[model samples]
Target: HEPVPTEWTRTTCPYCGVGCKLEVGVAGDRIVATRPVIDAPSNKGHLCVKGRYAHGYVDAADRITVPKVRHDGRWRSTDWAEAITLAADGLRRVAAEHGPDAIGVLGSSRATNEENYLTQKFARVVIGTNNVDCCARVCHTPSAAALKHMLGTGVATNSFDDIEQAKTLLVVGANPLENHPVVGARIRQQAQRGAHLIVIDPRRTGLARIADVHLAPRPGTNVPLLNSLAHVLFAEDLVDRDFLAARVEGVEGLAAFMAPWTPERATQLSGVPADAIRRAARLYALERPAMALHGLGLTEHLQGTQGVMALIDLALLTGNLGRAGSGINPLRGQNNVQGAAVMGCDPGTLTGSVRLVDACQRFEAAWGVALPHKPGLNAVTMIDAAHAGKLKALYVIGYDIFASLANADVTAMALSKLDLVIVQDMFLNETANSFGHVFLPVVSSFEKDGTFMNSERRIQRVRRAVAPRGDSLSDAEVLCRLAGELGFGDQFRHTCAEAVWDEIRAVWPAVAGISYGRSSRHGLQWPCVDEYDPGTAVLHARRFANADKAKLEQVDYRPTTECTSEQYPFLLTTGRTLHHFNVGTMTGRTRQQLLRPTDTLDMHPYDAGQLDLRDDMPVRVESRHGEVVLPLRVSDAVAPGQLFATFHDPARMLNRLTGPVRDTVTSAPEYKVVAVRVRLA
Candidate 1:
């Protein structure tokens, strides 16, 4: 039954970490108007340009309305039944020939909680292998590992609303204004209210404009800078002695270890002034309450896990945890990144960030699947195995790995070599271009009912506003149908998403208090373990995860894979724009493209002049991995010898120059630093 008429339906924005609630006005099938939902908490009445206008991409010309199969070297439209049969047979063939470890599934950050949950479930249960991973491995995996090590929980300790009460705020690695607009707006208001602002980044971002101390350190230098800050606070006796004695452990061990990293020694490595480091530390410690907020700028590097650990070290030393205004928060890039990870998206871990090998007995009893005891390969490892002809099939959901992975040419060849490539997405993407056997079209956010966990670990409801487009189905529906087709219908018989959520909560204690009914009243944060418990906002208030004991791990910084030489003297970094989302899958067809199209490689004036490059002039940036020709835009926002490029454009192939020099612990690529020489084309 089709609806007669409706003014608007409340929904959530499909862009950024802010996750602003929106009112999608519907006349018949199309969104006639979009406005901010005034009653929502994240953004009361404010909507960014991306949220207000980027919805046009939903109805774009190239949307994959039906399933497709590659035939005669081109894609041909096909029915979903035939496509699924072909995909299933192909998966069986790959498994028979190459083994269970040869098949892998790639999850997405953009997917619904149910979709992500089902995808991982299928990978673990049906595939009989642990080779299941997601986009979180690239961005927030380091943050998760670091937080779980330092504080028992990986979720945000304080809510974004708590910025108003903070006395001092330290932002590192992220440019919130461009990446997270609404959250940035709130922090700006906090700054206006006399809270001390300290920003540390390689680039001079919008947040830096109003910051009292903006430490512009060199790329890949965050570890040293943070250690130096810790050193200053400990030497000056500025650390909270009472908190260290009562709440923390291993303080004496950490203090003795970091005695070598003085302000003068760290200044040489990070290129930040010694005075600035000392002043910032003293101010943050002396302030009533201070917070450390981070983004991908901190976690998408060679030493990302260690960098995050250093930030946690600072927070613990200053006694900033478990408070109203102070905690270490990683401003998540996509909605549900934290939730997806918490729900067991990692191949090596189970839900609640528990190691797979350790928790297999408990999970086996709960799911009745005799889960694999050995940990599996991560995203980067799977790609490498595929290229080596060890892996044969890949089932990608929601994410465009062809663009997200490092080294575009290598990734393309790897995909081409696969025996079966199944892509589930709303659009026919680059991954579907090379030898894919099946494509499954999934529902958009407006066409679905589920929940999304925001940056603060708050899970909110996302109700359906419109019908599925043209026989298309929601991801959960499709996965359940696929399970039936694959002979696991009885086991996967979930009547509703609520059933799945409840099962997950019963097995995993972190989300014990999260339910559809509880979330409807108000979004519930995680670590809600009891029936009458309200979800925890800030964690590690009194003690750390290791039984009230936080152990400091010693780590050292390593330069990126591509280092500066005489020929390639510039460091090229890639990130997002204010108007675009990842790979422009959603934002490219919008009015924002008319506002700004094509990719721009941002470089400082000094570097541009030295390289004989001018604004809007085509320049070739060459790295050891690959080379890309792009128009150069000289901007003062970037520091000298540093170049920035947007990753949304496929033509630019910004990822060609980025390869994997993974962190030792977390395996996150160093997308922030790669040496490239810029020359006029």
Candidate 2:
């Protein structure tokens, strides 16, 4: 007999927003190997360790293969029809008694654009509520709100491919090497190609090690540092007057707002040298085609929106917009979070960046239902409402509230008080195990056919590699069946993912040109307006979306809500590790778990010496809200008065120590800065 060849299927990585193209080798329903796609535009044949090896989670023993319902405080496996009936009836009963606004739906960042589209549709049309949101509420909501307000778009202005064309790259508050490895590789490659790399972070990350200028400012002082840089651009006369005159607004007021933030004053507050600030400013200004990138470090603060706006001020000050290598970029943390927001999973906006008032009319004409015009509760407010007994029902898709939220105990209490808690995911996570009333088993991305919009706003196809595991269903199928059972069958009668996608294309003008057939050969960046049009690579080249000019805002530095005190003498920050993904829902089940089995509290050697703490010694880290005990690792990466830890290990539960304070503009929790006290266990 001749040897048989394994079948290969192309799909996008399910890990981060880099959207690395992957090739999976399947043999008799089992994934045998994984490789990178050589021709993919974003990743260009490079994959992170999680993207290459995390497929083991698909066949894990704990994979949920059947739907379950709780009876007498116990779970019992059931068929799809009974589960759908129970779920639909539970939600309908809550809506009838408490009003539709009492029911909130949390769409998943890990889900497909089609699935998220149906998620918001089912919430608005079938249930007649605007209480729909995604995980972006906790992550990139500020980036979306601030970027859209200033630059007229909520996404990256230039493609990842444009990084190679830059002369200077300013990276702020993001550790991309550990979080977005593919993009990190590109940044390193650009650095080797003689681009001036300026890293602004409290801790020295991998990129910071090789950066020409590393400004290790104090935590939560990004606004002042960025303002000082802009002041230098003004003081040194390095600003692009022509670009400001042609394509920008509000420049006259910026100088007055930034007057107080001289290089010396900023150095006094931020701990970075004044000369270093001037050097970074000149490099970013004189170096033509300079680009800037930022992450949660800039967004997870009390002044997060202001921090983003300040970075945008720098880009616009140097004429860095509407070009090949220049623009502001945000490294989104999740795979499909951009897609989820663009598909109208947010309470504030409808699909394609349409406001709620306009979306009501457009969606009503398209879906044949009257949509809610009032704004709904966000993630943090929804928990508060549930605790107050105002929110009766919650339908969560692929999110573990207890594990990911700021206060684990409080989130658990709110979920426990809900009349109906429906959780749809691949596993029985902390949320499902504690409070889920009905559990709908959902398949992994490997077994689904859909599209994921990446960090660059590129819509890529995720082809089905194998049949769904056992009785597990795609999220689209579950939503379609649930909508049908809720008497919206005529509107949501789609039988395939492509049918749902076609409806999305027809409704959202930004993605009007995108189709399964068009993106099959390769991915397409959004704003592809027509069927014959090729997707856009750079945004705002000739003009902004709403106006002909981009808007500049005057922002000021604001101190964090929580500051270091005598009782809590240290500041703690949270981030991700290269080996583990967020909350470790899927990566924990794979071989990656063996690479990093537990979480550790990272501290500076000076702080460890002051407390007589040694490496691998157990210690208790306590904040005003909560505490966690973990083994300590003393490293020079952190400042003396600061501490660091990852949220991958559930045992440590780092979010418990974070406060409930959120950004004023977007309700994103301030996870980066928390006052804490460290003691030996």
Candidate 3:
């Protein structure tokens, strides 16, 4: 048996974006136990199964301890010296053969702000290219882009604590109970306390079942549904005229745009009844202090950015901005997803989400290098470029593009053509196993000292709970060594994560005041610009009154390419469950796998009955892109013509069936709506 833990370290949970504070028990170099922190602000004394049991994955059997280099098409473990040298040489050779624009770098949400910030800098300064993007491109990039464009910042206007004070809550495209348990628990508890709850989804989610008003719109019709809701607010005179007169502009333009959308018309397009739309609108409008929370359901669609803006428009229409119990908030999927974008890991942005070209001179002065001025390709576009032989090299940092990308079969073909593929992660993921030329093993979050920004935009400390498993290093350490090998080590001089954070603080205005010295038992929310600023909880308080009044843009809904036909009758949607995280990389190795060891495709009982399909029957689900066979789950949770599934189990390869239909503005994939045909094999 393990010896009794003599020491304990406080850190944030590294699973979902709920950011539950945890205390990990340690004896010497081993972590023995973990429990929720009683006074933690986000998830006080509450933990889901993942937070409770997912720590055992750090010592997983397949963890890569040393770096490996592919020689003669075979793998051979090598020392750090040869590994870094080999990677540097390959990158140089690629850059020499095909210019800087031919290289692309992909960052991961699993990494820290310091690591991601440095990764982008390495791409811009060392490689002399802006071809860097993060996992958010496939996840919440729509939220960030739409929110930033509509509002001043690309984050939640209010804090999570607002859920308690809200008299009415609007949850869209999210089943918090399954995906984010702590937040779900609180939202569910609010309903039990007699708060009016409204849930909007195609299928009846757990919260939707208990909600006072549940609006089920057809998949891919979020625009019509939301526009119809706004139309009701306008037609019934439920909008807050005083708030609009004082703080908003472009009303006439929006009025003209929304004039054609009536609840009846929305019913025709979205398959939802007019009565339900009006009822949900009144319940949300009449209720004082109404708050909204949404997840990937609002995103991961072709009109994702517009849909987000529509959701924000409702809050704005009701005067919900800058209030305690009422505002728009996004529910994130991964722990550091917000941080990846905040750190400016995208091709077009620099630290703090500023346009790279606008900040080029400033960065060049600081780092002593002429930064890349032109914007480069995003994640999806990078893959397309690689497939077309335009991109020659790719750097994947802790992300499994082969498993996460839409039409992953095409991704495999694209990566095979790369001259060099460098992968950095704890394990050899699908992308690494298939096309990796150099592999650098990295330590887990439990063995690294850094920080993660939660869904609520709170920055918290992540202390090292245990020593690294073997010769594995933190991502920051690996990047620093690689920069030294490639020349211009002075520009990337960071001995530790804290040192990297210092540079981040100097560049990113939102996080300038968040020093490691600050007490982190309760993490600090951003827009903490100076040393003495206490940090902002709710934004746009007085600013909407003065020159910084919110601008109301006229946005219209557009349809995606995924249209159901006689050949492909059923619509497919994707999401996660309570027991696992994305791609099942970490949780699969832990005891959590026992809870859910495989994947299943959920079809409504009525749909299954038509084909003589029973529960747990194997079926082949084929889409326009690819196909996968999964056990059928005859569930009433989905609608008659809609199906649902989770891609947590990678072997299922559900993404293979999803094509590259993405949002126009942010390029977020339309994972929520697809046409597929199912049959018994």
Could you tell me every candidate's TM-score relative to the true structure? 0.97, 0.98, 0.98
lDDT of 1 at 170: 94
* Residue 488 in model 3: lDDT: 68
lDDT of 3 by residue, 305-415 (tens): 989999988888888888888888899899998898778789898888888767889888878888889998999999999999999999999998889998888988999
Clashing pairs in 2: none
What's the lDDT for candidate 1?
Answer: 0.82
Candidate 3: RMSD to truth: 1.3
When summed lDDT is taken over every stretch of 10 residues in candidate 1, the lowest stretch is: 1-10
**What are the Cα lDDT values of the candidates?**
0.82, 0.91, 0.88
lDDT ranking, high to low: 2, 3, 1
Runs off by more than 4 Å, candidate 2:
1-5
Which residue pairs of candidate 1 clash?
A: none
